[model samples]
Target: AGWQGTAAQVVTHTLNRMQDEFATNPADCLAYIGTCITQPHYEVDERVASRLPETHLKPGGKPGKWMADLKGANLAQLLSAGIPEAHIEVSPYCTWADNDHYFSHRRNEGTTGRMLAVIGIQNKPS
Candidate 1:
């Protein structure tokens, strides 16, 4: 099966860093695939959300694609965890817009193909 979602990259970077720091030589990573549901700019959805005291997002439109916000937060967390910024690479692929290339659970409505990434780690022996 193809790999799914953008989280896979982050997952791999994290694993790779851990393996290196722990002197594990090399390591491998698995797919980080799952459902992702966030606010869409649909009129009806926005209208309903406006009435709620607490919302899925802040008042002024969506916050820079909260999915991306979560990603940025994840990036920060990983950095705090000792992973360098230069070591981590995040794709700018937008699921909703890059449907032609990347598979989107939302755009394809559960019938989409996934993309996979292959990482190899040759652990150093202690």
Candidate 2:
């Protein structure tokens, strides 16, 4: 399958799994971290666009690869799962593709290292 189709399947499956998992193991809050490449829509190929469910072909940035609001998409998913907007947090960093701090598949052409971000609440002291 192409990247576009793979992305769509992953997002849909992940969201569905999250909904099921949260029902049995609910968290007080959720955090989403990653870089959403900010660019013009023209930069993204039709196949890429078709895979993304939250892409808006809006203008107002670089000439290509219109900004993809991953955070917004995640928020929407969370909201649909009954998670309030206020309970979710999004990071501002753009990851490796947009920044040197992280590894980007686009920048390195699938030869980049992986960056992981983990989240969990610590037990409170009585």
Of the candidates shown, which would achieve the greatest lDDT relative to the real structure? Answer: 2
Error of 2 at 124 (Å): 11
TM-score of each: 0.48, 0.58
Candidate 2 on 1-126: residue-level lDDT in tens? Answer: 123433555434555675576642234545453454443312454445555554544433445444445455555555655555676666665544455776656666678776665545455599
Clashing pairs in 2: 35-94, 39-65, 39-66, 40-64, 40-65, 40-66, 41-66, 43-65, 96-102
Question: Each candidate: RMSD to true structure?
Answer: 8.6, 5.2
**lDDT digits (tens) for residues 1-126 of candidate 1:** 111222244544655666667654221222222222222421123444333223223444444222123334344445544556665665655556656766677667789886666555545499
Model 2 lDDT, full chain set: 0.51
lDDT of 1: 0.43
Could you tell me how far off, in angstroms, the CA of residue 33 lies in candidate 2 after the best superposition?
Answer: 3.1
Q: Least lDDT summed over 10 consecutive residues: which range in candidate 2?
A: 33-42
TM-score between model 2 and native: 0.58
- Give lDDT: candidate 2, residue 76: 55
As a whole number from 0 to 100, the lDDT of residue 44 in candidate 1 is 23
lDDT of each: 0.43, 0.51
